[model samples]
Target: MQTQCGGCKQGGARCCCRCGCHSTAASGGGARLCSLSIPSGRSRGGGGATEICRSPREGTRKAGRQAGRMATRMFEGKDHARVYQKYRFTPQEALQKAVFSYLDRKAGAFGLALDVGCGSGQGTLLLASRFQKVVGTDVSPAQVEEAQQAPHPDNVSFLACPAEELPVADGSVDVLTSFTAAHWFDIPRFMREAERVLAPSGCLVLTTNTLDMRLHFRDRDQELTRIFQEFRDLLTPYMSDKVRLVVGDYEEIFEAVPFPSKERITDIVDKVPMSVAELVGYVQSFSMFQAFLKDRPEEAQAQVQRLQERVLEAMGEASPEARLEFWNRQVCILASRGPVPDHDPRS
Candidate 1:
């Protein structure tokens, strides 16, 4: 379905950021929109002709200060990137299926794919076999280096570059994606660049898994889950305000996409199997947790220890090697530059 908007005259009727500025998080996942911020009502656009009410906010690099900070590059150094690589598991088949379904293409059918903010290239490699050539770009040099060093198909390459300043030629990318990283971007610039780089029939995907993650085992799911949440809660103070974009399910980022054809799917669920220790490692991989460790080393170490101890006790496991389940609810935004590829399901 197509919706048209993005027009602003009187300094742009842009009710933009009107959402982020007013909407509060509901207990069950949704925004309680301020009466003045009519989501379905026509507002003005600051950059385009007509503004659709679906998306939340955006502006250019020259105006990065408008968004406060232009976003600083984090996850530096080989040690940190390697920790990210080892603990941060990529979303598997389910995510791919959602993208393919949106693109209306079979696996391995697309010509080129670009994964922006691709940390460690895990998701970039996931696209390699599917596309004839795949390039992963990240702001972090260490991340790019790690991705380059990973075992990957000959079609894939990695480089360090900011998302707003893509090195790609215009209209050259068939599919563009940012996984779990758009929140940290200068949204307006990145969105503009996404439109510039995509083929007319290309699509854009931005996905981030919500932190409402769950822990599971045989029968003691509730207690185990509590242990995980409590552990995560302790790390909350270290989380950046930028993470609010994710907590809001990328509505703000989605607002930036210029495409008239776009959809947000908040129900994509990804399940990963892991050992209890690995689950803890995944949390350790969190940027917030890393920050916690930096600011409060002894306390951070104690928290990790406490988490392992509590989780193990709850599971009646003697060691951290016991099997565990990691489940996440992912938020995905799929938008086409124009028309999606002509595709037949049975083909």
Candidate 2:
């Protein structure tokens, strides 16, 4: 006999509090935000899960803050990066919102949209709708395979390749972009590849979201704030020296690449709602989480469970069906790469 999974039966299967695995569902019809809900049990294929009872009131601001603090303290090494990559393995649903979020800001016609580090082609499919062609590539073979299976326009394709060596010919792409993963990249080499593949009038778009909760809560929510402060402290070490270099000033770094474009930079502040379980799922997708699990299995497993409880506890009267709003800052750097320089033979 198969066990009935509470999460799968209770509307959505992404929230398995028992297993610390979460699912993300995108709103259909191209909504700008992706909504997440917490389910009760582990996902066991089909609908197999066991339900357990805890106070729906367990989800409180104070608990979530504690979970966030522990999470921050846990993910501080290379192991967490591995966990971060796995987060992309779950669903491509977020791609539509993420891609549309950028394209809606772009002006003029674009021929091709290239997504670097396009794990599983979520963004690739979204871009396909707006441009003549879309190409998504990632360094992981499993991700490439998953991306290949996504429904896409004839003009959209997925490939497995490192960011430093994209397969496309020089100047063949019209728009090159990345979402959230640029910080993990070899900044100089990735920029060089972007410069090489983009057409004379092509554009390079890069954006990343910094998770901030202080913007989401009132002063009465001190517990939530403490949790995030801990999370931030935990994540500070492995942010990659390269990513740190780009912080505070997108201009200085863009110029370092000599992208040769009139640049337009913008900052978008958005409120994202997530349950405590969903928050764990989000962090599980980060590199820090991956690194933590790889190098410290016992610690990682314990931490994941602790985080789940804390998140649920912090929900603070928010309906299990309700949402938790967290603030984020997305920085977009759009640099236009003009025509290539004319090469002249030595006199």
Candidate 3:
């Protein structure tokens, strides 16, 4: 059975709901003010097959200070990259199936798939399974390195580049995708790049899972939920302004897609059964959690430990696994250049 909130009654069945969430004003507009066009003399695919384009170093001392003034920043450093690779969960199969189904129906070619902001190659490798070639790009060179180190097919490659300055030829990409990473991007610039690189009948798909997760135990669901919510509330102050796009369930993001025939599918819930330790590790992977660690390391450790202890106590001995249902409420924005022709008329 399915609930109004998109939760499933079965063990691992995913579901959805149609709730109207409020959208907030766009942030990060003045943070990195730069022209949308590709810089003059920079040809498409100018970067090598696996190039790492390091952002130019700050020239003057004051330039360094100005760079630090940006409101949003990419996740960097070796520690953060390691934590992300270790703790981040894989993309749900249901979500992948949904994405591929849409592409198969509408996209005219599977020539090239570009996954912007692809951290550690999770979603990039998924695209590789279906597309002829896949390229994953991230602003953080560390993240790109981690992605490159991960095992993947030969057709998959990693590049260090910002979303706005994609090193791809115009009208060359058949599928452009961003998974849980677009909120950190300069939306207008990224959208412009997407429009420039995507082929005439290519497709652009952006997806993100919401933060409102639910935990379920046989008899202590409420208690577990309360514990998780309180922990989330503590991390809210450390979160960046860009997080508003995700909290609104991508309502604002959907509107930003520069296409007339776009679709937004929200409330796609996925339930995964995991141990209490795994659940705690999952929480530790959050960007805000990393921020909290930076600001108050001792307090963050204490709170996370307390959360784990509480979860273990509530789960009882018989059932060591708890249902970690991500009300992943994924907002999948899908848009194609135009209608796809059917070679097989019957199909």
Candidate 4:
């Protein structure tokens, strides 16, 4: 399933970190998201004197003050760009964590694997160790360049390509996987292409985590539903009629695409206990939040305050431990090629 709502505009549920946000301990043999406390001495790098990885509240007042002053002067335009690029790698980090967790459990299932949009080679590293042959592909030359430099066994390689048009020949890959990057893909075309490339019985694994995005003064879960509805509306323009049919249901995925003899969908929520500060960092990472502030700064700022206060109230009542939850779903679609032919039926 694809969740495109970034967490900024919506604060509480199913936002960018909305769904991808709340991570919990691993159950059902899959990995879960957890908070890694920033060491005391660790510097909170640029981005307006904000605390590193804490709730937005800790720095919001100061940040708001700074943002107000800087908003007038366009402070450090180039530096902001640099920081954005550097920290924008969170999604990839999350993807790598998921891939490795999968490898830790099912590495022996396939001798060859394909990682689509294998940015920075993080996922490829794990695939290379498990499969005798691994091919990583992406659309960005810069990403591909970085990926090429990453160390891999002789069996692993990286390439640049779009999802609709993969370079690999037909019926060759033993296992096919896409990380959190699949939402950007043209699902129908990618599925057709995936089916074409997989050797009979190969599995196509696709996953994208949506953070929890909440509306101001709305029930936490209610905000999630609103954000999802808004996201659905946003995607309507981008999706083809064929792809549109599959929204909010797994059955649509199977019906529109041919492959997939068997399929299973699992929701893996990473629930981390958090303070107000950590929640804000998670919120700012969202594209919608960035855009919301860009288009409607006054309104966005107000929403930010409400979310921070709501979280603080929760934290006060929370256990001695500050908890943050990063929730995500891992959807695995397994399909078989030719039927049992030579000997298996009787054996």
lDDT of each: 0.69, 0.50, 0.67, 0.45
lDDT of 3 by residue, 1-347 (tens): 11221122223322111010000002211111111122123335554222112212211222224324421455676788877877677678668777877887888777678898888878888887776667776776567667767777766766555777776667778889999998988788788888898877789989887886878877677887888889899999988899899988787878888877778878566666677777777788788998999899999999999888777776664333544443345667888876777332224
Per-residue lDDT of 100 in model 1: 71
Q: Best by lDDT, which number?
A: 1
Which regions of candidate 2 deviate over 4 angstroms?
Answer: 1-108, 150-154, 211-222, 237-239, 246-252, 264-266, 317-322, 339-347
TM-score to true structure, per model: 0.77, 0.62, 0.77, 0.49
lDDT of 4 by residue, 138-165 (tens): 5543454455554556666554456566
- For model 1 the TM-score comes to 0.77
Clashes of each: 11, 38, 0, 55
Per-residue lDDT value at 237 in model 1: 94
Write down the RMSD of all candidates, one decimal each.
14.8, 17.4, 14.0, 18.3
lDDT of 1: 0.69
Off by over 4 Å in 4: 1-109, 119-128, 141-157, 210-250, 266-279, 290-310, 317-323, 338-347
The total number of steric clashes, by the backbone 3 Å criterion, in model 4 comes to 55
Ranking by TM-score: 1, 3, 2, 4
Model 1 spans > 4 angstroms off: 1-70, 105-109, 341-347
- Judged by TM-score relative to the true structure, which candidate is superior, 3 or 4? 3
**Alpha-carbon runs more than 4 Å astray in model 3:** 1-71, 317-327, 342-347
Candidate 1: 10-residue stretch with minimal lDDT: 29-38
